[model samples]
Target: MILDSDTTKVISILGNDYTIKAPEGQEQALMDAVTMLKSALSETKRSYPTLIGDRLLVLAALNLCSKQVELQRQHAEELSRYEEQVSATVEVIEKTIAQG
Candidate 1:
Protein backbone atom coordinates (compact mmCIF):
# COMPACT_ATOMS: atom_id res chain seq x y z
CA MET A 1 0.00 0.00 0.00
CA ILE A 2 1.31 3.42 -0.93
CA LEU A 3 0.81 6.54 1.14
CA ASP A 4 -2.93 7.12 1.33
CA SER A 5 -2.70 10.75 2.39
CA ASP A 6 -0.77 13.17 4.52
CA THR A 7 -2.37 11.77 7.64
CA THR A 8 -2.01 8.12 6.71
CA LYS A 9 1.15 6.53 5.38
CA VAL A 10 1.89 2.97 4.45
CA ILE A 11 5.48 1.80 4.36
CA SER A 12 6.77 -1.56 3.35
CA ILE A 13 8.91 -3.24 5.96
CA LEU A 14 10.32 -6.76 5.92
CA GLY A 15 8.13 -7.76 2.97
CA ASN A 16 5.02 -6.48 4.73
CA ASP A 17 2.97 -3.36 4.50
CA TYR A 18 2.60 -1.41 7.73
CA THR A 19 0.20 1.47 7.99
CA ILE A 20 0.79 4.47 10.20
CA LYS A 21 -1.70 7.13 11.02
CA ALA A 22 -0.33 10.35 12.39
CA PRO A 23 -2.18 12.27 15.03
CA GLU A 24 -3.43 15.72 14.17
CA GLY A 25 -0.64 18.17 13.20
CA GLN A 26 2.12 15.54 13.14
CA GLU A 27 1.81 14.05 9.70
CA GLN A 28 5.01 15.55 8.39
CA ALA A 29 7.01 14.40 11.38
CA LEU A 30 5.61 10.89 11.08
CA MET A 31 6.39 10.75 7.40
CA ASP A 32 9.91 11.98 8.00
CA ALA A 33 10.40 9.29 10.62
CA VAL A 34 9.20 6.61 8.23
CA THR A 35 11.66 7.85 5.65
CA MET A 36 14.44 7.78 8.19
CA LEU A 37 13.61 4.23 9.22
CA LYS A 38 13.57 3.07 5.62
CA SER A 39 16.95 4.62 5.02
CA ALA A 40 18.36 3.02 8.14
CA LEU A 41 17.07 -0.40 7.20
CA SER A 42 18.42 -0.17 3.68
CA GLU A 43 21.82 0.95 4.95
CA THR A 44 21.92 -1.85 7.50
CA LYS A 45 21.11 -4.46 4.90
CA ARG A 46 23.77 -3.10 2.62
CA SER A 47 26.35 -3.07 5.36
CA TYR A 48 25.66 -6.64 6.43
CA PRO A 49 24.79 -8.73 3.42
CA THR A 50 24.89 -11.96 5.40
CA LEU A 51 22.62 -10.57 8.12
CA ILE A 52 18.81 -10.80 7.80
CA GLY A 53 15.63 -11.49 9.77
CA ASP A 54 15.43 -10.28 13.38
CA ARG A 55 19.11 -9.46 13.61
CA LEU A 56 18.88 -6.90 10.83
CA LEU A 57 15.92 -5.18 12.44
CA VAL A 58 17.58 -5.19 15.84
CA LEU A 59 20.76 -3.69 14.47
CA ALA A 60 18.86 -0.95 12.69
CA ALA A 61 16.91 -0.19 15.87
CA LEU A 62 20.10 -0.09 17.89
CA ASN A 63 21.67 2.34 15.46
CA LEU A 64 18.66 4.63 15.69
CA CYS A 65 18.65 4.43 19.48
CA SER A 66 22.33 5.24 19.66
CA LYS A 67 21.78 8.26 17.41
CA GLN A 68 18.88 9.41 19.59
CA VAL A 69 21.05 9.19 22.72
CA GLU A 70 23.79 11.24 21.13
CA LEU A 71 21.33 13.87 19.99
CA GLN A 72 19.80 14.05 23.49
CA ARG A 73 23.20 14.57 25.02
CA GLN A 74 23.99 17.38 22.61
CA HIS A 75 20.64 19.04 23.25
CA ALA A 76 21.18 18.87 27.02
CA GLU A 77 24.57 20.46 26.72
CA GLU A 78 23.27 23.22 24.48
CA LEU A 79 20.38 23.90 26.82
CA SER A 80 22.77 24.19 29.74
CA ARG A 81 24.82 26.75 27.85
CA TYR A 82 21.73 28.77 27.00
CA GLU A 83 20.63 28.69 30.66
CA GLU A 84 24.02 29.89 31.84
CA GLN A 85 23.97 32.72 29.33
CA VAL A 86 20.52 33.79 30.47
CA SER A 87 21.63 33.72 34.08
CA ALA A 88 24.63 35.90 33.33
CA THR A 89 22.53 38.37 31.36
CA VAL A 90 20.04 38.56 34.19
CA GLU A 91 22.79 39.19 36.69
CA VAL A 92 24.13 42.09 34.60
CA ILE A 93 20.68 43.59 34.27
CA GLU A 94 20.12 43.31 38.01
CA LYS A 95 23.47 44.94 38.78
CA THR A 96 22.77 47.84 36.42
CA ILE A 97 19.33 48.39 37.89
CA ALA A 98 20.72 48.38 41.42
CA GLN A 99 23.44 50.88 40.52
CA GLY A 100 20.96 53.22 38.79
Candidate 2:
Protein backbone atom coordinates (compact mmCIF):
# COMPACT_ATOMS: atom_id res chain seq x y z
CA MET A 1 0.00 0.00 0.00
CA ILE A 2 1.29 3.49 -0.85
CA LEU A 3 -0.01 6.78 0.45
CA ASP A 4 1.84 10.08 0.23
CA SER A 5 4.89 8.14 -0.93
CA ASP A 6 4.75 5.78 2.00
CA THR A 7 5.96 2.17 1.87
CA THR A 8 4.57 -0.84 3.71
CA LYS A 9 6.57 -3.36 5.65
CA VAL A 10 5.65 -6.39 7.71
CA ILE A 11 6.81 -6.65 11.30
CA SER A 12 6.19 -9.12 14.11
CA ILE A 13 5.70 -8.18 17.69
CA LEU A 14 5.25 -10.90 20.29
CA GLY A 15 4.67 -13.43 17.51
CA ASN A 16 1.87 -11.36 15.98
CA ASP A 17 2.41 -10.09 12.49
CA TYR A 18 1.55 -6.50 11.63
CA THR A 19 1.71 -4.40 8.51
CA ILE A 20 3.25 -0.97 9.05
CA LYS A 21 3.38 1.93 6.65
CA ALA A 22 5.68 4.93 6.82
CA PRO A 23 6.68 7.77 4.56
CA GLU A 24 9.67 7.34 2.31
CA GLY A 25 13.01 7.47 4.12
CA GLN A 26 11.31 6.78 7.48
CA GLU A 27 11.06 3.02 7.36
CA GLN A 28 14.00 2.56 9.69
CA ALA A 29 12.52 4.93 12.23
CA LEU A 30 9.22 3.07 12.13
CA MET A 31 10.99 -0.24 12.65
CA ASP A 32 12.97 1.25 15.51
CA ALA A 33 9.74 2.29 17.18
CA VAL A 34 8.38 -1.23 16.81
CA THR A 35 11.52 -2.63 18.35
CA MET A 36 11.18 -0.23 21.25
CA LEU A 37 7.57 -1.26 21.82
CA LYS A 38 8.47 -4.96 21.70
CA SER A 39 11.21 -4.34 24.23
CA ALA A 40 8.80 -2.46 26.46
CA LEU A 41 6.33 -5.33 26.27
CA SER A 42 9.03 -7.78 27.15
CA GLU A 43 10.10 -5.68 30.13
CA THR A 44 6.51 -5.37 31.29
CA LYS A 45 5.94 -9.12 31.02
CA ARG A 46 9.11 -9.86 32.92
CA SER A 47 8.26 -7.40 35.66
CA TYR A 48 4.72 -8.65 36.06
CA PRO A 49 4.51 -12.33 35.40
CA THR A 50 1.02 -13.79 35.01
CA LEU A 51 -0.22 -10.72 33.22
CA ILE A 52 -1.35 -11.38 29.67
CA GLY A 53 -3.53 -9.91 26.94
CA ASP A 54 -4.97 -6.46 27.54
CA ARG A 55 -3.60 -6.05 31.03
CA LEU A 56 -0.05 -6.50 29.89
CA LEU A 57 -0.59 -4.26 26.89
CA VAL A 58 -1.99 -1.51 29.08
CA LEU A 59 0.99 -1.64 31.38
CA ALA A 60 3.40 -1.48 28.46
CA ALA A 61 1.54 1.47 27.02
CA LEU A 62 1.68 3.28 30.34
CA ASN A 63 5.41 2.66 30.63
CA LEU A 64 6.07 3.89 27.12
CA CYS A 65 3.90 6.98 27.63
CA SER A 66 5.62 7.82 30.91
CA LYS A 67 9.02 7.58 29.28
CA GLN A 68 7.92 9.72 26.35
CA VAL A 69 6.62 12.37 28.71
CA GLU A 70 9.86 12.42 30.63
CA LEU A 71 11.87 12.74 27.43
CA GLN A 72 9.69 15.62 26.23
CA ARG A 73 10.13 17.42 29.50
CA GLN A 74 13.88 17.03 29.36
CA HIS A 75 13.97 18.20 25.74
CA ALA A 76 11.94 21.28 26.60
CA GLU A 77 14.30 22.14 29.43
CA GLU A 78 17.37 21.77 27.22
CA LEU A 79 15.79 23.85 24.47
CA SER A 80 14.96 26.61 26.90
CA ARG A 81 18.52 26.58 28.22
CA TYR A 82 19.90 26.77 24.71
CA GLU A 83 17.61 29.66 23.89
CA GLU A 84 18.76 31.54 26.95
CA GLN A 85 22.38 31.02 26.04
CA VAL A 86 21.75 32.21 22.51
CA SER A 87 19.92 35.30 23.73
CA ALA A 88 22.77 36.17 26.09
CA THR A 89 25.29 35.82 23.31
CA VAL A 90 23.24 38.04 21.04
CA GLU A 91 23.00 40.65 23.74
CA VAL A 92 26.76 40.61 24.23
CA ILE A 93 27.32 40.98 20.51
CA GLU A 94 24.94 43.89 20.33
CA LYS A 95 26.68 45.59 23.23
CA THR A 96 30.08 45.20 21.58
CA ILE A 97 28.74 46.55 18.30
CA ALA A 98 27.23 49.58 20.00
CA GLN A 99 30.48 50.36 21.84
CA GLY A 100 32.71 49.93 18.76
Candidate 3:
Protein backbone atom coordinates (compact mmCIF):
# COMPACT_ATOMS: atom_id res chain seq x y z
CA MET A 1 0.00 0.00 0.00
CA ILE A 2 1.12 3.52 -0.74
CA LEU A 3 1.18 6.09 2.03
CA ASP A 4 1.29 9.84 1.63
CA SER A 5 3.41 12.19 3.67
CA ASP A 6 0.59 12.85 6.07
CA THR A 7 -0.19 9.20 6.64
CA THR A 8 0.16 8.11 10.23
CA LYS A 9 0.89 4.52 11.22
CA VAL A 10 0.31 3.17 14.67
CA ILE A 11 3.08 0.77 15.65
CA SER A 12 3.71 -1.07 18.89
CA ILE A 13 7.14 -0.98 20.52
CA LEU A 14 8.14 -1.94 24.04
CA GLY A 15 4.48 -2.68 24.77
CA ASN A 16 3.47 0.88 23.83
CA ASP A 17 1.76 2.16 20.73
CA TYR A 18 3.24 5.05 18.75
CA THR A 19 1.78 7.09 15.94
CA ILE A 20 4.43 7.82 13.28
CA LYS A 21 4.19 9.88 10.11
CA ALA A 22 6.15 8.79 7.04
CA PRO A 23 6.39 9.58 3.34
CA GLU A 24 4.75 7.55 0.59
CA GLY A 25 6.24 4.12 -0.17
CA GLN A 26 8.46 4.41 2.89
CA GLU A 27 6.18 2.77 5.44
CA GLN A 28 8.02 -0.52 5.20
CA ALA A 29 11.37 1.18 5.64
CA LEU A 30 10.08 3.03 8.67
CA MET A 31 8.71 -0.16 10.14
CA ASP A 32 11.99 -1.92 9.50
CA ALA A 33 13.87 0.84 11.29
CA VAL A 34 11.48 0.55 14.21
CA THR A 35 11.99 -3.19 14.29
CA MET A 36 15.75 -2.71 14.50
CA LEU A 37 15.26 -0.22 17.31
CA LYS A 38 12.97 -2.64 19.13
CA SER A 39 15.56 -5.36 18.81
CA ALA A 40 18.26 -3.09 20.17
CA LEU A 41 16.04 -2.05 23.06
CA SER A 42 15.18 -5.64 23.85
CA GLU A 43 18.81 -6.69 23.82
CA THR A 44 19.79 -3.79 26.03
CA LYS A 45 16.98 -4.61 28.45
CA ARG A 46 18.15 -8.16 28.73
CA SER A 47 21.73 -7.10 29.51
CA TYR A 48 20.74 -4.31 31.88
CA PRO A 49 17.48 -5.17 33.58
CA THR A 50 17.92 -2.36 36.06
CA LEU A 51 17.66 0.27 33.35
CA ILE A 52 14.17 1.54 32.61
CA GLY A 53 12.18 4.08 30.57
CA ASP A 54 14.24 6.94 29.15
CA ARG A 55 17.51 5.41 30.19
CA LEU A 56 16.81 2.22 28.33
CA LEU A 57 15.81 4.10 25.23
CA VAL A 58 18.91 6.29 25.45
CA LEU A 59 21.18 3.30 25.74
CA ALA A 60 19.58 1.65 22.75
CA ALA A 61 19.83 4.83 20.73
CA LEU A 62 23.47 5.17 21.66
CA ASN A 63 24.20 1.64 20.53
CA LEU A 64 22.43 2.12 17.22
CA CYS A 65 24.07 5.49 16.69
CA SER A 66 27.50 4.03 17.35
CA LYS A 67 26.94 1.29 14.83
CA GLN A 68 25.65 3.78 12.28
CA VAL A 69 28.70 5.99 12.72
CA GLU A 70 31.06 3.07 12.23
CA LEU A 71 29.21 1.88 9.15
CA GLN A 72 29.24 5.38 7.67
CA ARG A 73 32.98 5.64 8.28
CA GLN A 74 33.57 2.34 6.58
CA HIS A 75 31.36 3.35 3.65
CA ALA A 76 33.28 6.59 3.23
CA GLU A 77 36.58 4.73 3.18
CA GLU A 78 35.33 2.28 0.58
CA LEU A 79 34.00 5.11 -1.56
CA SER A 80 37.35 6.86 -1.39
CA ARG A 81 39.11 3.69 -2.52
CA TYR A 82 36.69 3.27 -5.42
CA GLU A 83 37.17 6.87 -6.47
CA GLU A 84 40.96 6.43 -6.44
CA GLN A 85 40.69 3.31 -8.55
CA VAL A 86 38.46 5.07 -11.07
CA SER A 87 40.84 8.02 -11.26
CA ALA A 88 43.79 5.72 -11.89
CA THR A 89 41.86 3.83 -14.57
CA VAL A 90 40.94 7.08 -16.28
CA GLU A 91 44.58 8.23 -16.23
CA VAL A 92 45.71 4.90 -17.73
CA ILE A 93 43.12 5.17 -20.46
CA GLU A 94 44.31 8.68 -21.25
CA LYS A 95 47.92 7.50 -21.43
CA THR A 96 47.00 4.65 -23.78
CA ILE A 97 45.07 7.01 -26.06
CA ALA A 98 48.04 9.41 -26.19
CA GLN A 99 50.48 6.58 -26.99
CA GLY A 100 48.21 5.11 -29.66
lDDT, candidate 1, residue 93?
100
Error of 3 at 62 (Å): 0.6
Candidate with best TM-score: 3
**Per-residue lDDT of model 3, residues 13-95, tens digit only:** 76789998878788889989999999999999999999998899999999999999999999999999999999999999999
Error of 1 at 13 (Å): 1.1
Clashing residue pairs in candidate 3 are: none
lDDT of each: 0.88, 0.91, 0.92
Q: Ten residues in a row with the worst lDDT in model 3?
A: 2-11
lDDT of 3 at 83: 100
Q: Which pairs clash (backbone N, Cα, C closer than 3 Å) in model 2?
A: none
* Candidate 2 Cα outliers beyond 4 Å, as residue runs: 1-5
Alpha-carbon shift of residue 3 in model 2 (angstroms): 9.9
Query: Cα miss at 78, model 2 (Å)?
Result: 0.8
| Tens-digit lDDT track of model 2 for 1-100 | 7447888999986677889888899999998988898899999999999998778879999999999999999999999999999999999999999999
Cα error, candidate 1, residue 63 (Å) = 0.4
Better of 1 and 2 by TM-score: 2
